[model samples]
Target chain A: AQRVTQPEKLLSVFKGAPVELKCNYSYSGSPELFWYVQYSRQRLQLLLRHISRESIKGFTADLNKGETSFHLKKPFAQEEDSAMYYCALAFTGGGNKLTFGTGTQLKVEL
Target chain B: SAVISQKPSRDICQRGTSLTIQCQVDSQVTMMFWYRQQPGQSLTLIATANQGSEATYESGFVIDKFPISRPNLTFSTLTVSNMSPEDSSIYLCSVEDQTGGDEQFFGPGTRLTVL
Candidate 1:
């Protein structure tokens, strides 16, 4: 069974501080990881994928096969960055199915 | 990116009743999925809505309890039958990006509260 774990239920940081949302996965095969964000009153949207290796909104995540972790990171947190972040994993031959982790509520204080 | 919409954005229903949530996508998509988000929990995939065929349900999800229909590529519906208070959750529909990048675009979910 493929499982994604996000340890933090809530992460609070002041503006301009660095932010890191931890995520780990348990999958046997090669896994593709992604980060999704949902702002207040907005629908869920894709933030970035590991395969792309591109940063979105100053957020970046690297897939660590050795540690089985794909943590989201941002250098300077902005007040507008407050939202719910979800880490998801998909494996080969899974038919595009995604296993999501319990989201982390990021509250960036002014 | 696809524009997705869900009907009956929020509904309060009595126990034993059923509520059908409709999902519509602006463009045709090959794979559509239904998900449930319980209060304070992560989103769980319910099933994959296959066009012109029966939906493929995930483990622990049964067709009898959550019936899904995908008559076409752009539309799908999920019905929660014999609802209970435990069924209170936000049901969302999403479409896989046609470019095949494994990214999914989600619709504004339908919030159901059963009392």
Candidate 2:
């Protein structure tokens, strides 16, 4: 079974401070991890994927295979960064099914 | 990325009634998915909807409770049957665009409140 765990349900950070949202996964094969963000009044959207090896909106996540973690981090948090963040694992199969973690609500306080 | 849209952005429904949510993609997609997010919770995948076959439901979600239809590649519908207050949730539809690397783009979810 594939599982993703997000330990924190709510994480508060001050604006201009660094922030990190933890995520860990359990999978048998090479894991494909993703970070999806849902801002207030907006639909859920993909922030980044491990396979891309790119950053979006000043956020970057390094897929640590040894740690089995893909923690989303930003050097300086902004008020606009406040949103619900979800970490997901895409299984290696035909259907392309995804197993998601319990989301972390990021509150970037001004 | 794909442009995905869902109907009835929000609805208040009475118990025992059913609501059918429709998902439309701007471009044709081979794979579509349905998910549920309860109040103060994360996303839970309900089922996988393909273009030309019966939907594949995940554990704890049955076809009788959540009947899905994917008659074509660009469109699909999910009907929540026999609703209850516990069923109040935001249901989301997502698609995998082959061109858009492994990321599943999501729709503006339908918020359903069962009373």
Candidate 3:
């Protein structure tokens, strides 16, 4: 079965601190990974994807095929960065449905 | 990224009633999806609302219970029929916008509460 897992349900850190949200997956074939974020009272939005190899709001994720992981990391957390973050995986064979992890609530305090 | 909108941002409904959620996109998208986000759970794809074709439901979802309609390239609707308390959750519509690898854009979501 293909599944995405976010080990931590909640993560808290002070502003300017380094932050890391771990995400792992179990799949049989090549998987495309992405990170989605939902701010308070806001819609779920795509933050970054492994394929893009680009950083957004100082966040970056790397696809580790051997480890089956795509962890999101930020060098300096901001108070405005507090939100719910989800890890998603797209199976190439299906109708392009996205499988999502349970999600992690990040709270960056001042 | 494409802008998406959903109607009835939040509603409280009685059990055994039904509610229809609407989704509209700013541009014509190739893929439209309906999702359920129950309290304390991740978003689950209920069905794929393909324009001009019957929806493709997920394993645990059915067309009879959750009827979907896609009338055009940029609009779709999902109706939750015979609702119960279990049906109370946040419903979201999404579209995949990508050149190769898929990245999804989502609506603000409709929050349904059953009593």
Candidate 4:
């Protein structure tokens, strides 16, 4: 079974501070990790994928195979960056099916 | 990326009733997925709807409880049958990007609140 764990429920940080949302996964096969974001009154959208290795909105996540972790990080937290972040894993042959983490509510304070 | 839309953005229904949510995509997509998001929780996939095949349901979800229809490549519907208070949640539909990769585009979602 593939599972994703996001340890934080809510993370509050002041503007310009660094932010890190922790995510860990348990999967026997090679994992395809991604980060999705949902802003207030907006639909959920893909933020970044491990395979792409590209940053979106200054957010980046590195997949660590040894540690089985894909943590999202940003150098400076902006007030507009406040939203719900979800870490998802897709199975190698599971046809793009995703198993998502509990999600982290990031509140960037002004 | 695909443009997706779900009908009945939000609705409040009584228990024991059924609500069918429709999802339409701008372009034909090979894979469409239905997911449920409970209050303050992450999205959990309910089933995968293919164009001409029986929908494959995830564990803990049954066909009798949540029936899905995929009559074509660009449209699908999910019906929440015999609804209860626990069935109140946001139902979402997403389509895999046709261009390639594992990226998916999501609809606004149908918010169902069972009374």
Candidate 5:
């Protein structure tokens, strides 16, 4: 069975500071990792994907196959970046369901 | 990428009553999925809605309790029967489009509160 693990529940940082939300997964197949973000009172949206290798809102995640990790990082955080971030893994199991990790709530203070 | 929409953005219902949530996709999709999410928690896959066929539900979920229908590639619905307080959660519908990748686009979601 495939599973996603997000070690942090809450991460607090100041505006313009660097932020990293840790994520790890357990899967034997080639994993397709993604990051989704949900702002207050808004719908959830895709932030980025490992396959795209592009950054959104200055956030990027690198899939480290050997480490079994895909950590989301932003060099300079903004107040608008405060939101709930989810790490999801899509694999060929359970009818290709996207297994999501318990999200990490980020609070960017000024 | 695909765009998805869900109706009844939120509702408060009494116990034993049922609510049906609707999902619509902008373009034809290959697979539609339903998921449950508690506040401040992760998403749990409820079922896979296949066009012209009965939905395939995951463990801990059944058709009798959560009936699903996918009449076409662009639309699906989920009905939650005999609701209880435990059923109060956000239900989301997603799609796997022919965008040349396995990325899934999600709807805004329907928030149900059973009392």
Candidate 6:
């Protein structure tokens, strides 16, 4: 079974500070990791994917195969960056059903 | 990436009643999924909706409580029957578009609250 684990429930940081949201996964097959963000009163949207290797809104996540981790990070946090972040894994050939981790609520204060 | 839409963005219903949520996609897709996200929690897979067949439900979920319908490639519906307070959650529909590296596209979830 493919599983995703996000260790933090809430992370508070100040503006211009660095932020890191930890995410670990357990999957036998090659994992396809992704990060999704949900802003207040807005629909959930894709933030970044391991395959894309591109950063969105100054946020980036590197998939460490050896560590089985895909942690989301940002160098400088902004107040508008406050939102719920979810780490999801898409298991190939498993009906493409995505397994999502318990989200981390990030609060970026000014 | 596929564009998805869901109806009844938010609703407050009494216990013992049922609610059917609708999901529509801009393009045709083969695999449509239904998920339940409790308040401040992760998303749980409820069932997989495929055209021309019955829905495949995940563990701890039954067809009787969450009946699903896939009328076509671009649309699906999930009905929560005999609802209870515990059923208060956000219901979301997603698509695993094979063309888009199977990246899942999510719909604007339906927020259901049971009294």
Look at candidate 5 and give me any clashing residue pairs: none
* Tens digit per residue, CA lDDT, model 1, A1-110: 99999999999999999999999999988788999999999999999999999999999999999999999999999999999999998755436788899999999998
**If you assessed candidate 5 against the hidden native complex, which CAPRI class would it receive?**
medium
Best model number under DockQ: 1
Model 2, span B34-82: residue lDDT tens: 9999998778999999778999888899999999999999999999999
| Model 5: per-residue Cα lDDT over A56-108, one tens digit each | 98999999999999999999999999999999998674445898999999999
Cα lDDT tens digits, model 5, B8-92, are 9999999999999999998998889999998767999999998888899888999999999999989999999999999999999
DockQ values, each candidate: 0.84, 0.79, 0.77, 0.82, 0.68, 0.74
TM-score of chain A of each: 0.96, 0.97, 0.96, 0.97, 0.96, 0.96
In the range B82-105, model 3's lDDT, one tens digit per residue, is 999999999999987765356688
TM-score of chain A of 5: 0.96
Model 4 reaches an interface RMSD of: 0.9
Clashes of 2: 0
> Model 1 chain A: which ten-residue window has the lowest total lDDT?
A89-98
CA-based DockQ, model 6: 0.74
Q: After superposition, how far is residue B23 of candidate 5 from its true place, in Å?
A: 0.8
Off by over 4 Å in 1: A92-94
* Ordered list by DockQ, greatest first: 1, 4, 2, 3, 6, 5
Q: lDDT tens string, model 3, A1-110?
A: 78999999999999999999999999887888889999998889889888789999999999988889999999999999999999998876445689999999999999
- In model 3, pairs of residues that clash are none
Superposed model 4: Cα runs more than 4 Å off:
A92-94
Clashes (backbone N, CA, C under 3 Å), per candidate, total 0, 0, 0, 0, 0, 0
lDDT of 2 at B15: 100
Give the TM-scores of the predictions, in the order they appear.
0.97, 0.96, 0.96, 0.97, 0.94, 0.93
Pairs clashing within candidate 2: none
